[model samples]
Target: MRWFRKKSASTTKTIFGEYCATSSVHGVRYFSDPERTLCEKFWWIVMFLVSVGGCVKLIESTWLKWNLTPIVVNFENQPISVTEIPFPSFTICPPGKISKLMYNFAKEAKQIRNSGAHANAYGSEDCFSTEFE
Candidate 1:
């Protein structure tokens, strides 16, 4: 199988050459023409303002339909209850209280270590057992 095939022809003519060439004429003239008339500038400004207004209207309608309208409908159908909603509540402990709790935890951990309870809790005797096999 041939991996790299050379193109048969150079300077190939495209079927839509006229369409592409005609389409670029307006864009090229709009950008490259320095001596534009006042009428052209006014026309461009009108087009820009109209486009912006259209975009704003589109966004407003979309927001109303997708976001605001649904919220309003939901509120009208089923009113929100404070007790039914599970709002997050935080218990803010002082730094001193947190430190005291940590100290107590460490003391209990040290006692468990001294009593050999921590070693037995790990069940190290089962480490070499082949009970599963």
Candidate 2:
């Protein structure tokens, strides 16, 4: 009983300390990001949305990129080159594995996806269909 009491007290202190040190709401730490970075925050958001899948498509309809590329100048409109967009930005990750740079890359990728840089980018319905199918 004495050992149990000591163990519980220590565990409680550890958890409370962590919560106090981080930004949290409702006793739930939203961002445990010890090393703050724009990319990490963005990726957190991306991962959250992607987990919902359908809602992510609705919240940010341009997050999905099924082999989508960036756009550059074209015959009529000389837009940015979709094919030449940098790496790590235009790709999705397998959750909790996203890096800050990859999140940055994903942002640009999402923009390109929205801009129809790829002639065959997946639509909302199409994207959901593929995910489950």
Candidate 3:
């Protein structure tokens, strides 16, 4: 701590000290490098805050992209088995909508079957696979 003193009894002050004493302590004159002082004072504070914010944003973006994004993957394109989901014990509502949907699917499937090989050769809308439906 003693060694950190600006001046010792025997040592003479250098030009830098004389400049500091004249301009900073006694004189009203200021240095031209205002931005240097501003940066020196605020650099670490700004950089640390920005880095912390960036890390938080990075974590948030990763979570959104991976977990929050709604991905509608086609089961036919992948090798993953589709039988893993646990069936609900009870229906949330009446089963009329389900029965109607099944009836429509059966009717459409029957129509496809009735429209035979002639339908496939001349690519009509009726000839398309049930996947299009």
- Model 2, 1-133: lDDT tens digits are 9999999999997886587457444323433445657676567666766667976666564544433543344564555556655565576667678676754655565565556654465544333232111
Candidate of highest lDDT: 2
Count clashing residue pairs per candidate: 0, 11, 0
Better of 1 and 3 by TM-score: 1
**Under the 3 Å rule for N, CA and C atoms, how many clashes does model 3 have?**
0
Q: Residue 79 in model 2: shift from native, Å?
A: 12
**For model 3, what is the C-alpha lDDT against the true structure?**
0.55
- Poorly placed runs, candidate 1 (over 4 Å): 1-33, 71-133
Task: Give RMSD (Å) of candidate 1 vs. truth.
Answer: 21.1
The whole-model C-alpha lDDT of candidate 2 against the native structure comes to 0.57
Q: Write the per-residue lDDT of candidate 1 for residues 1-133, one digit (tens) a residue.
A: 2332323222132323334345553332332234667677567657767778999999999988876445322344668644565656998878765666555565665566566675578755443232221
The local distance difference test score of model 1 is: 0.54
Could you tell me every candidate's TM-score relative to the true structure?
A: 0.29, 0.21, 0.25
The local distance difference test score of each candidate is 0.54, 0.57, 0.55
Model 1, C-alpha of 39: deviation from truth (Å): 0.3
Candidate achieving higher lDDT, 1 or 2:
2
Error of 1 at 93 (Å): 46
